[model samples]
Target: MEQLIIQLISGAVGGNAAGSAMKNLSLGTLGNTIAGLVGGAGGGQLIALLGSGAALAGGGGDIMGMVTQAAGGAGGGAILTAIVGMIKSKMSS
Candidate 1:
């Protein structure tokens, strides 16, 4: 239960950061928050699959592992948002 909350929060932060960073693509506050949550959760799941012996070993995934994955996703989302912003700026100008 606690772990779930953590992942959800991480995702919200990342998405918000990314959304705000992007120029015209800004998802507004609500949009950003939702994006972050989804991205983080998705990232965490992806990480678990990759880390567990090609996604076959850990039949029972770890909570800590998922948390870390969510963090990575949040970070990635921020970076991606920045990149998108840059591209948009270049195109606009």
Candidate 2:
């Protein structure tokens, strides 16, 4: 229960960051918030699953832990968006 809430908040933060970092994504405020939530929670789940219990219960769902992971994921996502945006720009012309 606590874990879920933390994860949600983490995701929201990450998605919000991602939106801000991305100039071309234009998900809007509400969309960005939703995206952040999804990204944060998804990243947390993925990390836990890939870590194979190593990340589980070990600050895995904690506020700081989730925020850090979410930030990383959001940054990665922003980078990905930049790459995609560049590719699109180049291809469009």
Candidate 3:
């Protein structure tokens, strides 16, 4: 639970950062946040299933586990945000 919360927060931050960096791909704040949340959950689960985040899944309270989850969430959030932004831009074009 703690890991998940960490992931979500990290994801949101990542999404916003990406959005700000890529002006052409910037989703509004609300959209970025929503996408980040979804991506965070999915990414965390994927990492856990892949065994890289097994410690987090196992409910470990270690700092490393939290960091791993945060990394995964942030990457996922940025990737998803980019993809969505590209798609949106294309569709509008």
Candidate 4:
């Protein structure tokens, strides 16, 4: 639960940051956030499936595990946002 929350927040931040960094791939704030949330959830589940679930959600004091999860979520969010942006640009063009 805590890990999920952490991932979600980090994913949102990552999405916004990526959007700002890549102007051509930037989605509006709301779009980025929505994409980030979905990506975050997906990423968290992916990480769990990859066998990191126990380490991440096992102990309440597992800071490093939480950080790792956050990183995964962030990366997922950024990647998904980029993909969506590319598709949108292509469709518009």
List model 3 lDDT by residue over 2-87, tens digit each: 87887788888778878888989989998888778777777776787898888878977877788888988888787788889899
- Preferred candidate (TM-score higher): 2 or 3: 3
Ranking 3 against 4 by lDDT, winner: 3
Off by over 4 Å in 1: 52-67, 76-93
What is the overall TM-score of model 2 with all chains considered together? 0.57
- Quick one: best lDDT, which candidate? 3
Candidate 1 lDDT, tens digit per residue, 2-66? 43455567767887777765647665677567666666656555654566322222433665555
Per-residue lDDT, model 2, residue 42, is 62
Model 2 residue runs over 4 Å out of place are: 52-55, 58-93
lDDT of 4 at 56: 77
Clashing pairs in 4: none
lDDT agreement with native, every candidate: 0.59, 0.54, 0.83, 0.80
The 10 consecutive residues of candidate 2 with the worst lDDT sum are 75-84
The list of candidate 3 runs beyond 4 A from truth reads none
Q: Which candidate is the best by TM-score?
A: 3
Per-residue lDDT of candidate 2, residues 25-91 (tens digit): 6365676666566555665556556663234347554555555555545543444334444565577
Descending-TM-score candidate ranking: 3, 4, 1, 2
Quote the positional error of residue 1 for candidate 2 in Å: 2.3
